[model samples]
Target: MRQRLTPVPADLTGTVVTPGDRRYAGLRSTYTTRGTPEAVLLPRTTAEVAAALGYAREQGRPVAVRSGGHGLSGSSTNDGGLVIDLSALNRVEVLDRATRLVRVEAGARWAQVAAALAPYGLAISSGDHGNVGVGGLATGGGVGWLVRSYGLTVDHVRAVKVVLADGTVVRADADREPELFWAVRGAGAGVGIVVAFEIEATEVRNVGVAQIAVAARPDGSTLRRWAEVLRESPRELSTAAMLLPYGSSTVLSITAVVAAESLRRVRPLVAPLREIGDLLDDRVDLVPYPALVPTAHLHPNVGQQPNLTTNGLLAGMDGGDAAAIMRAARGRHRALVQLRSVGGAVNDVPPEETAYPHRHQETLVVASVFPPHGPGALDAAWRGLADRVDGAYVNFESRADARTFGRAYPGPTGERVAAAWRRYDPDGLFRAPGRLPDLTASRG
Candidate 1:
């Protein structure tokens, strides 16, 4: 019976990608540059998605949902399983201006939504770059430029429509399925495939942004200084620091952003960085966030390879930790070290209240570098390089880990979210790496 689905549906009004098709290969390949899927189902509507899931469930076929295909994990593909391409459902709608709310399809990009909301003087709290999908980003503990002030991408989410393992299509929000809603915020991809999202938009206009890069300091003194600065900076301003090395020199990239309210008056705050080092270039200007993305695109590209990253929260690390990282990065691939200044609104909400942890941590440090394919010795080099760091980022973990997923969230949030996942998916159908497992016991 499942063989009938092999042919492209003529009446479905959406594209169906099957094996042996030219487009099938590209559609099935994940952005991680890893594995490919067996078959692809592109559904244009929520009902179509439900139907696809119904078909898969009846056939007892394992299924994986593909959003951005940008996830670092292999969640979007299977060796021989059904794959749902949700990018077909990508849509964004302005619900009401007075209410400051919008409905976005699961496949919509942060750039698309921000562009859609610019005319209304409103925007959702989104991540740094514009290319990332809102669905996966929000579900994986979204930490964005606006997070320090407004909160996470999930914090603004009002509701989500999901297709569960049993082919159940349900809408969950703050007031409806509150338990599932809480879990959906952090565990949506694991619990089910989210089709749409309702989010609260923030009022923002001309904002101040600064992109500064300087010659490598003797130590991370300047980088650490930036971290301290971000901690006390007004909530209106957000900052992130990156250490990049080229040849014998390393550059400290400090990016500072001020919310619209302080757009015109942030020079006093940004001027301190100029004195921190031998300045290379500083571009500080006032512009709408929608306009800032052009500058955001200038940095490293996550698509070049399968990214392996180690990320965690730190209270306060002296210069010694920086030295250890530098020593660990002695080879060809210079590790791009990142330390996010996390605080403000992120701390006001209790960690257990949501699936996202790392709220109380004063700062977050991430070590990111992609896999290199070369001489046989390179594999050992990469493995030995990662040994210098501890643990992995949920967003960047090679794949989901059932045993340690609970540890990703702070407090008892992981266990609480696991219970909600059971109530929703019940079967281990939607499970992915770096996320909780499906509620198989409940389904049994």
Candidate 2:
């Protein structure tokens, strides 16, 4: 039996692969094993993106956009719909060397951006790994090695070029389309596809890197103390502490970065961390800003595992919360609880200033359970911890329901974002995975 081919959009400048195509399997693969879309549209230019969106609107099919394809929630891929793949638009350019202003295409990876700006001694505070796409992280509020020192990637965004749901191309910034600019910073996926971004970079020299293994305390006194130190530590240092199960006893793997040119400045910033637990292993050195990205840690297995993850932002943790976290970490095998210190310059930005409203958060906690494993227990454990925190970082959230989305963008902030969704995408042609409320209908 012959199957009828789905017609590709006539104006699409890039490739389109359907279900029966040989390349479909490879094109549809992502960081998590998500459902295959009916067609994958790879658009290279902004006009082509508009054409694809117009076509998706005409077909009345759900539209999902893919960048680096490393989204843990698998929102970038879907079944029986259109997946806009932006891999062909990966270009990083230095717009101004003096101000360290850089322009990055949506499809570009943080690593490529890093490598491009390294020669000029410029860097953008991005996700921990280099392979993470600029579009997803920048829009959703980036938390990275330089978070404490420089703030989120979205903080540095000077402007953005977005294709709204109606296939209209618009430039958003503080002075132009200001409301859309605010919405795109944190709740981008809900409104439109960001084709490119102009980011203001920070000048830097060699930065300090520390990878340490410390013995974990079951009662979580160490975890509490670690949090205290990070709260009091200098903004120059940012750290991510991971609690992993290690036969009979748990281990805390600490990765810290200090944005400094000398070992003298780095040593004092890391001294408090050294006092955490029995230091099982320690490695501290200075590396170029780009080298700070831990590429090896980004999706080490690719799309093999069904990645289950939960995220929360804590203003401060008490003894009860620490004990709860330790208990959760011990529940699942190969489960990891990552707590990143996040309140330096990040807190300097007022909650109302940007779409990201978590400026009050002291720490960002991420609980991940990897594959070759069981089921509901992982989610159950993560949910228990989520109850303790104020909110969740959108990038780290795994659940794709309206409830989870509400958690990610909550209260008045959520309402504003929904209003933006209504204003920019009244018809809702751009379909995000979650069951977002019908704000447009409500407006009617």
Candidate 3:
């Protein structure tokens, strides 16, 4: 039987929530709100985490960890297990401005971090939105506009403070626990809970950002242009063009962002598309990085939707392949497709090093159903469509099996990662959608 602490620990400083707790429902729900846990433990300090883990280990109870609650796969949330909620550990210290490095608590959200760092004229290469937690996103192989110039967020991670499964606390950095550090940089959360992250900050200020909407070209001409432009364009700019369906007509919503002072400087580069033919609603302008994340979630009322796409170096989108790929997604099923350019600093690192595999692929063609996720669903359509996908981005990942995760990383890195995970989490306490193989066992 599980050890029941009816009255809770008197010495415990942080909040301990049970089924009767008023905040239990709110604490249990994530952004996706799919997974549910038995009880929630909000530990204010790393010491509290260690204590809780020690208790669970003694009781032989399973435990899961959560930071941002933005996990798409419900990996952090649980149905009937103990959860170490680190959402309270939101502390960011500007350790060294000269070194351009910042230490952020695992619970720190990018939104707060960005605003906090803006005053110092320094920021980390974070994902698109400020709401996403720095730890969860980085561990899953972060890919944002900054990715084009600086590489994944993991690449910038200098060190991490984590509590292992067996109540052991350790620090992983380039100098300490080098192998564990490498594994944590990309797959840290897989083995344990990270309380804090030490990452190199980028000196970023205001820049030119654009959101252009256009009439979708069904014949594949629009895709061809996007592929050619992104492949040949200079590394200074990063662009992602999306094709969404509205009624019978398709709308191409393109977001072209760059680190330039004014949009005019890059107008000539995008002029080719304007010359190609007619488009609708081109609202390309400069805006703050924080404003880019439109506050919204895709509608999920309907059944499962169709989403088929790919991500690779721009070279992978050959003329014929690009045309066929785009054409496959343009239909009544409403598979919104996006072609993302990858070159800049993202290509600086080889795929073999990190769990994030696609370092060289130039463009990521992602397509999925429009609204809702069910019976008579669009799952089959998307499954069949995306079956041809050559790459799997852990960040964009839905619920994929082990084989699907194998393709998440490059060559031998996948097996090596499995090995690391199995060693730490021998029993796979947190089993969910995005869980990889027993990394430790694989390594063994």
Candidate 4:
């Protein structure tokens, strides 16, 4: 028998979509998991968001909050529950061109945000993919194309407008509601529904981009040289590398983004990278900053990409650590491994200033497994790398287990994050499943 959903509230009469509704098909799932929610509430304003939250609470169902529905863990959608979809509330406006302070709605994709700010010669350092939601990336750590120069997207957040579990709307910043503001920067999933963010944009009209592919040796010497070039290079250059199977061996494919506007300056910075190994391919171009994350990447999420992903932070990739990464990519399971240069402007921020405290790490390593493989396969491929990694990033992780949370938060950061979550949301309404155990007891 089909479950009967409660009648939609008068305020949400036109906004609610049920199973039989034609719109329900598009709103039913995330990027990684398919969901069958009883109803999906599409709110266009902050007041409507508050109403939607109240309606979900009255239904007595597990509630999931979705911004752009691109979350890797699939926590944005639930099997049989209510989903507060915020895609309609997307709006980007420049409050002050002098200060480069821009207000962005949570529902907006990074592509839309970049397009909106292009006219004003302003841009936020969002993720590489244009389809990623602004809320998810900004709240968590944003390791983007200009990350080494401008830092994480969360680092530029000036304030946030959030709707709490009790349907109370509040604005948090450095001077007001400081604790809530701090928690929202990195560990926001457990606190409340953030409707919008006020972020400081950078002045960037054009950037130099280089796409290079080189032959990678099995012993990890090539990998070490790649890291060495990034560490010694100026803060203006940031790169993302992927280890891929090339014929009988693996090749390292890299996309290097330099913050300079002219090719004259970009060539010298990336010259060292080409000399690392036998170059398979190399290309450089000076394109508009918006081109890096173009609107062409935008698409609806209907569980199109299904993969299990995990990541770790490295203070520095030594020969042993580098070999472990290569081995994981070439192992029996053949997990896909990717690396991002971190530790430029990212490390300039003190660890205690925000919820994201992995400030000392120099590189971000991510590994993923697709179909025909499960958690065991992923674990087996990652076993050799488990000890070498110093920390983990919450956004890339597919599991919401206690162990994953510990690695993401670690030591005093975890304790403080737990206390803040409890203070703001005592009933645990927004907590991810199995994410918040008894941390004090676990530590003991």
Candidate 5:
């Protein structure tokens, strides 16, 4: 028998979904974890979201906040708790065409945002996947296809409308509620539920994309060469490479994105990458920016892609560092390894500028192990490259422990992030259990 749900506030009557409701099945889980939340509140407006928060607080149950529900950590849903589902609030509007400013609701997916901005020839550098929610990625960090040229999605966020833990609605920007605005850009999950963001989009209508595959040397020479090429290349070029098992060896499959409109400019930018290794396959196409993150990738999250994921950032990749990464990818556990270029425009931001302070890192290394294998296997695989990593990206991590907090928010950045989280959410209302470290304790 289903447990009885507490009576919801009158303001949230139609917005509340219980286990008995038909929609509960779809609302109870995320992409990486299954949940059994007692109630899922679907707020359609800022007022409704405030009401939903009040209603959930009265029940004295753990509250999980969700935007697109594609978070790798699966903190958006919980067992027998209350979940604030923001999907219904999705809206993308061009606030100012002259300045390329866009007002995007938190619930809006990257795909929807791309589709909405296509006509204006403006685009925000969001994550590679279109299904990823704007709230989570923008709040945390948005390393996207155009990252080298446009920078992270959070970097473009000019302002944000958030619903605080105490049911207070406030809009934060550099000039207004400045501290809250700083935390919202990178450490938002611990502070509040961000409903919308006013971002300054870039003028980009089309780009040149290339897919290249090459046989990698077991000694990591090929990986080192790939990094060298990227370091010397122009900011317009950004690439993501995956190391896959091929026959008795490994293959480095690379997707290079160039922020250039014509093939002539794109060809020259990506030419050096082909010389890195023995190229097996190569193709380049000049396509619209929206095509890179199309609506075709939209899908519901129902605990579909369960896996263990972790990541680390590297300042530079030497031959030894490259060897360690290759060993991890070909280890006994054999975790799937992916590398993304991250320097260029990302480094243009000063370390003290925002919550995401690791601006000097040149590469992002992510490793994932699907089920049948678990955390132990994932950890074992990551051991080789552990000491070489400079920092970690919060969005790619599955475990939200103290160590991760320290890495994601290092030194002064961590201290400021913790203080901001405590100031905005003194009662620890938005800090999901085990999802974030206790802000009161010294982050090790």
Candidate 6:
């Protein structure tokens, strides 16, 4: 039930939007969908966020937090609850030019960060989608154009400013609040609201964009060979294979980015992929490191399209797995299958070092169908390749399977994340949608 809107806090610096408010509709909308949130509080400061959390607790209303509102699971919006919109907190500051230390507010998008850092010839490894929120992506393992070169976004995180469930603000990092720091890196949705991220940006001038189009079918051998080629490729080269649906046929399109200073140096590394199938188009060009992320590809304006997605982390794809994936693609009238190459710098970090435990996985596979087609076929296809599936990336994840969550943060990492949840958010105010209860919350 929607709660009655109380008088706005006079001392609150940000805007409190409720039902019937002029901006309510716009504020309640996220990337994938919209929600009927009772109240949307746009907080400009950490203190305002804490106040809003306290207000939500006082009103006995569920709380949801939104940065760029790109969460695939729609965790940023809740029905008849308080949505703490952090869009006003967008700010990016370069702390150190020498070390490339930068402080980015949680609400700041990757495009804003890229634009801010480009003048300095500095860039943080982030998702290819420029409009993707810095907070959500960084927290849930960012696999971007530079995955092979710099590693996941969490790898470069120096620190984080988090607002606890009890409205307490704390700074977490390797030394300060180390446990919380570890949890915030990956299993971030369940814990608390992150206010800012202190990232160690890397220096890069230019990157090479590699694109190859091949007319393909569900032969299984084609995709298997593509995976093999990527596995042996140089660290500078990172690639993603997309199964694009055209009428009744599906085309296998491979796109790669070489995070090298020049295209001449990366040609040998990415040359073998051209012979994978009947090549239709091949283009390799040099551009600014930030320019590599195409705005059109992000699909920021996903209006009414019902996007059903499933993701899995794969160690290696055999012919059987590839065949299953192809069959799944062919079965669906429209299936968006994306397999991102993630091994070099991403796997370098040990699973135990952070909450993101799938370090040994070679590729991140995400399959989606818009407008809600045969949804069962998607899951069935994923199940066929279940043996090679170790874990799932939280950013691309929409399912709430206990086994999948267990795989995502396995062993001690799971235990530690639960511990952090209990320690900071005992009330379970920020529990992810369809997720199990936090340890302490369950006990209570």
User: What is each predicted model's overall lDDT from 0 to 1?
Assistant: 0.68, 0.81, 0.65, 0.90, 0.91, 0.79
Which of candidates 4 and 5 is the stronger one according to TM-score? 5
Q: Would you list the rank order by TM-score, best first?
A: 5, 4, 6, 2, 3, 1
| lDDT (Cα) of model 3 | 0.65
Shift of residue 386 alpha carbon in model 5, Å:
0.9
Q: How high is each candidate's TM-score? A: 0.86, 0.94, 0.87, 0.97, 0.98, 0.94
Residue ranges of candidate 5 with Cα displaced over 4 Å: 1-4, 441-444
| Model 1 lDDT tens row, 1-444 | 334444433444455677778777567756665454556788888888887776666645568787766676657766567778777777888898899989999877777777888889888767777766777887776777766788778877888898887777888887877877787776667778889998888898667788888776546576566666676577777777787775677777888777755644777667777667789989888878687543344322223456655565655545755554444343455655676666788778776666775566666666556655332323333354333333223664553655336446434666676666776766666764323454345332
lDDT digits (tens) for residues 265-298 of candidate 2: 8888888887888888888899988786644444
Candidate 3 lDDT, 109-211, residue by residue in tens: 7777777787787767667766677668877777676557667788788888888777689998878877677777666667777788888988776556666
Worst 10 residues of 5 by lDDT: 435-444
Per-residue lDDT of model 5, residues 1-444, tens digit only: 545567886777799888899999899999999999988999999999999988888888889999999888899999988999999999999999999999999999999999999999999989888999998999998999999988888898999999998989999999999999999888889889999999999999999999999999999999999999999999999999999999879999999999999999999999899999999999999999988889999988889999999999999999889999999999988899999999999999988878999899999999999989999999999998889999999999998878888889988999899999888888888876766777655531
**Candidate 1 Cα deviation (angstroms), residue 185:** 1.3
| Model 6, global lDDT | 0.79
Error of 6 at 323 (Å): 1.1
Off by over 4 Å in 4: 1-3, 432-444
How well does candidate 6 score on lDDT at residue 406?
A: 72
- Candidate 6 per-residue lDDT, tens place, 364-439, comes to 8888766646457567656665666778887886665555567677677777887787877876777744543445
Model 2 gets an lDDT of: 0.81
For model 3, the stretches where C-alpha displacement exceeds 4 angstroms are 1-13, 58-62, 264-266, 269-277, 293-315, 323-328, 370-379, 383-387, 430-436, 439-444
- Mind giving the per-residue lDDT tens digits that candidate 4 earns over 127-189? 999999988888888999999999989899999999998999999999999999999999887
RMSD of each: 4.1, 2.5, 3.8, 1.6, 1.5, 2.3
Candidate 1: how large is its RMSD? 4.1
Task: Judging by TM-score, tell me the better candidate of 1 and 2.
Answer: 2
Top of the candidates by lDDT: 5
Task: Compute the lDDT for candidate 1.
Answer: 0.68
